[model samples]
Target: MKFVCYTDWNQLPESANALFLQAEKDSLFFSRPWFENVATALNDDETMALACVVAGSKVMAILPLMKSAGNIGYALKHRYTPLYSLLLAKDDQQQVLACLVEGLHQLPLEALLLEPVADKDGHLEGLQGSMQAAGFGCDRLFRFYNWFLRVQGQSYAEYMAARPAKLRNTISRKKRKLEREHGYDIHLFSGDDVPHKMPDYYAVYSASWKANEQYAGFVDTMVARFSKAGWSRLAILYIKEQPVAAQLWFVGHGKASIFRLAYDKAWKPYSPGSILTSFLMEYVIDTDKVEEIDFLTGNDAYKQDWMSDRRERFALSCVKSVKPAGWYERFVASLKRILKKQ
Candidate 1:
């Protein structure tokens, strides 16, 4: 395997993108455009690099890393981005992962901080084993659940009937109330409609309780990119042709992610946000034929009601270079030994 480290995103060849597209699974975060957008948002505060493994003309794997003090952080850092992984071809996952770890071992860094890695169907097992074998220390920082809904071959009514009666009742009542009192309508803005409808989308967002935040700039910058790439989903709930709530999603690889959402606090009583979400869920499953819907990152109380199945996400710290164990590391290791003795 040939390992190449790239300090410039623009230097990556077009062929590299084609290789990623052909991978068994695509990680939205690991995509070249996503990395570029993130790097653009970060400015020069942090450095970025792409470490890729290639065999002759084919690229097998790639890791987009950000440089911080002495550690290499994941390319994107945000709450909405809960899951991350190396982009590796399906057939060469093991070899590519192991090779990537070996390359990391040669880098001069304190540790590689990878977070919110999916616990199921992830490379944690191979990653941890390779890091340990390379004389590195590996530890799981924490774990959290990411809720998702699988779109089985069932209609929206069939799926809705399976939900709890109380949830079903609440959704139906709120939906009807909004329609009856306010004449609400849901509009989907994707493809060409994204850029045109963004002003309306932002208007509702500005009226939301989460308005005027620092992340707005980043969202604005990235939304255009996502939209142009054909993955943006902006669904707005309108009352009298004015926006009240919006659900921002990113669709790719047959999966749709619930990226951001908000509603006008004035509509709080109407529960327009919840109504919009429910409507979009049906639209994606019954209309767009998406295979899955990911309620990314958070395990809010309401998410549990919406999604019965979940996948765990984990944070991992792998020390690439073996130094004398720090006091904290040694203490934690010893405590584990003592606890096991019990």
Candidate 2:
């Protein structure tokens, strides 16, 4: 196998295209479209590239990477990205990962940082082993918790019936009160309609309690791209013909992920967010019939009420011992660990 790096998407070989097509069957985030949007939307001081390990005409593995202005390397990710991982072929996983690691080592970087990696399938463990064998000092640090639900072939009604009584009651009561007091409508946009409804989404987001987005056009770009790919599930709640709440979801590969959500703070008393969530949940469960529903990247109390299982995301930090920057980083990390223990 030989290592090859591509700084531009157009330079990718046909084998790279074939690899992504196969990988995306497991998760939409593994697709080229998703990474392309992320690379385009990020407005940071970093140079993005794709590092690959290829064997003749076949691509064995790929890693999306970015080199920071500070000379450190990181996974090419955006604030909105929930999970990131190395894309490796099913055969010779360890060998492929090792080759990819060798490629990463060739870059002029002092250290490598990757975050929000899902480890349920042992990918994290595999990566750690490869890095350690390559003589890098690595640490696995906790990032955040992820919540999800397994549909298990249940109908929407059956799933709702199994939810907590208080949650069910609140959804029913709040929805009715909101409708009776000030008539409301919930619309789910997908495919062709998504572009037209984006303005409403922006309005609702701006008025919501969350802080302003750091990257200006990231969400808009992602929504447009996902919509064109038939993976968007954007829902807006309107009261008196004005958008009061919005939620962005993506459905693909038998899974639905709740990507972003916000509600007008003025409507907090009416619980518009919860009411809208209920509506979207029903649609995904009954209409889309997804096998799993992911409430990605959080430990908010409300997430527990809606999700049946929990998992953790972690970051892997690897430092090169021979580099001055890496040595300083190692020292700082050691100090921090000692302080935490104290």
TM-score top scorer? 2
Which tens-of-lDDT digit does each residue in 187-306 have in candidate 2?
889996887787888788889988875554777777777888899998999998999999989998889999888999999989999999988999999999999999988899999889
Candidate 1: tens digits of C-alpha lDDT, residues 1-342: 777777786777656877556532355665666666777665466777787877777777777777755444454455456567776666677777778877877777656766667665455677678778887777764457889888777677877888788888888899888778768778898876787787787888789998454677677777887788788889998889889998888887877889888898998988888788888888877877777788877778888777768877766677544455474486445434433442
Q: Give the alpha-carbon lDDT of every model.
A: 0.73, 0.83
Least accurate stretch of 10 residues (summed lDDT) in model 1?
Answer: 333-342
Scored by lDDT, model 1 comes in at: 0.73
Number of colliding residue pairs in each model:
0, 0
Q: TM-score, each model?
A: 0.88, 0.91
User: Which of the numbered candidates is closest to the native, going by highest lDDT?
Assistant: 2
